[model samples]
Target: MNETKLRDEIVGLAKSMFDRGLTFGSSGNISVRLDDGWLMTPTGSTMGTLDPARLSKLDINGRLISGDKPTKEAFLHTTMYERRPKANAVVHLHSTHSVALGCLHDVDPANVLPPLTAYFVMRIGTLPLIPYFAPGDLKLAEAVGEMASRHHAVLLANHGPVVAGKTLQDAVYATEELEETAKLFLALQNLRTRPLTSEQVADLHRRFPQNI
Candidate 1:
């Protein structure tokens, strides 16, 4: 898609997430790669009210080329773009359920979300839990960069989730799946649960190599 159309679509989808309570306030951001660089949501901008024309535009070198200033976590998006050649879009959301799960003590760093459904397995593979860094901290970007090669999605402990996909819509869908899986995992903690078996997980991985 062209830059303008991509920006419009991103803003529309982000607002839908906000309207559905996946994220609230100014607590989420989205970005899409462009020929010149990227189109990103601006800092402190609520997703529910994003304006496509005002979306931040950056050059290939990460320099601001036009529009408003990009979110402070733009480095996180840049890190993924640099590491994953197929990642054309990134979405980070301070989603309530996922962030709440991140705060739990026993959440595994290697597999932050459980394999409750095939869609989750096909969309979000193994979600690593990176230790919390202050929002917008360079260290957070560095931490994600360190894991970018192996994981397309990660849960920032005490924060939320970050997802990278081949397109903006794909990124958004994966993020929503992440949040849903996190919500299910948390809800099932108090019950006697039966997760997918090792062989089942292996089968799913084989079917969706990009996700796993």
Candidate 2:
């Protein structure tokens, strides 16, 4: 999509998530790769009330090109872009369930989401947990960069989730899936849940190498 249209679509989708309580206040950010740079939501801008024309535009080198200032977490997006050439979009959200799960010390760092459903396996693969850095700290970006080449999505411990995809819509969908899976995992705690077996998971990985 062209830059203007892409910006509008991102804002709309972000607000939809906000309205549904996926995120609240100014707690989430979204960005799409542009030919020249990137189109991103601004700092302190609530996802539920984003104005497309006011979206921040940054040059390829991370300089401000237009609109309002980019989010403090802008480096998180750029770092992933720099490390993962195929990631054309990034979505970071403080979705309740996912963040809550991240706070748990027992959550597996290698696989933050449980294999509760096939869609989770197909969309998110295995979500690694990156050690928490204070919000907006460049260290967080560095941590994400370290794992960018291997994982498409990660749970930022005690923070939230970050997901990269080939497009803006795909990133958004994957993040939503992550939250849903996290919610299910939390709900099924100590309930004798039936997670996918190792053989099934291995078969899935074999079939969808990209997801693995």
Candidate 3:
């Protein structure tokens, strides 16, 4: 997509997420990779009212080139792109259910969410839990980077999720799937449930091998 259309699409999709309460206040961020640099949602800007022309434009080294200042969590997006060359976009959101799942004491760190649905298994595949670091801590970005190459989606301990996709829409869809699955998991906690078996998950992976 051209820079102009990409910026508009980012604003539109972000508003969709914000309106539905996927993110609140200025708590989430989005970035799309560009041949020259990146186009990122500006720091402290609400997704509901992002100005396309004012979106931060950073150079290849992440230096701001134009528009407003980039989100403080910009490193989170940059690191994902650095580690996952095929990823063309990244989304970091403080979505409610995903954050709730992250706070659970006994959840698996290796693969946070169960294979609750085939779509989750396909889009997210496996999600690792990155250790908590204070906001803006470079260590947090490093932690995310360590997992980015292997998993396109990860749950930040005590935070939420960071997901990368071949396209911005794909990233958003994967994040939504993760949040919904987290909600289902929380609801099913007290009841006996049958999550997809290992064999089933493997079959889905085989069938949709291209899923990011």
Candidate 4:
């Protein structure tokens, strides 16, 4: 997509996410790769009210080239891009259920969510949990970078999820899936809910190999 179109699409999608309550306040950021560098939501900008013309533009080194300043958490997106060469977009959100899942003391630090549904298995294979680092901490970016090389989606302990995809649409869709699955997992924690077997998950991965 052209830069102008991509900026508009990113803003529109960000608003849609905010409208749907996937994120609230100024709790999330979105970015897409551009030929020149990157286009990202500005620091302190509410996702619901993004003005495309003022979106931050950064060089390959993550230096702000024009528009408003980039989000303090911009490293999260830049580091993921470095780790996953094919990932052209990243979505980081402070969604409720996913963050709630992150808070549970015993939730698996490795593969945080179960294979509760096919879409979860397809869009998000294994979600690693990164230890908490205060917001905008550079250390958190390093941790996410290391893990992101292996997994495109990760849940930050006591925070929320960061998802990378080949496109903005893919990243948004996967983040949405993570939120929904986290909701289902929390809801059925006290009930007898049967998760998809390891064998079934393997079958899906083999069928939709691109998801891996």
* Local distance difference test, each candidate: 0.88, 0.89, 0.94, 0.92
User: Which of 1 and 2 is ahead in lDDT?
Assistant: 2
The C-alpha stretches of model 3 lying farther than 4 A from their native spots are none
* Predicted candidate 1 versus true structure: per-residue lDDT over 131-167, tens digit per residue: 9899879999899988988899988999889899998
TM-score of each: 0.96, 0.96, 0.98, 0.98
Q: Which order, best to worst by lDDT?
A: 3, 4, 2, 1
Return whichever of 1 and 3 wins on lDDT. 3
Q: Give me candidate 2's TM-score against the actual structure.
A: 0.96
Pairing residues by index, what is the TM-score of model 3? 0.98
lDDT of 4 at 198: 91
Per-residue CA lDDT of candidate 3, range 9-101, in tens?
999999999999999999899999999999999999999999999999999999999999999999999999999999999999999999999
Stretches of candidate 4 above 4 Å error? none
Question: What's the lDDT of the predicted structure labeled candidate 1?
Answer: 0.88
lDDT score of residue 118 within candidate 3: 94
Ranking of all predicted structures according to TM-score, beginning with the best and ending with the worst: 3, 4, 1, 2
Q: Write the per-residue lDDT of candidate 4 for residues 1-212, one digit (tens) a residue.
A: 89999999999999999999998998899999998799999999999999999999999888899899998899999988899989999999999999999999987788888899999999999999999999978999989988988999999999999999999999999999999999999999889888999999999999987542
Please tell me which predicted candidate would have the highest lDDT against the true structure: 3
* Native-to-model Cα distance after best TM-score fit, residue 18 in candidate 4, in Å: 0.6
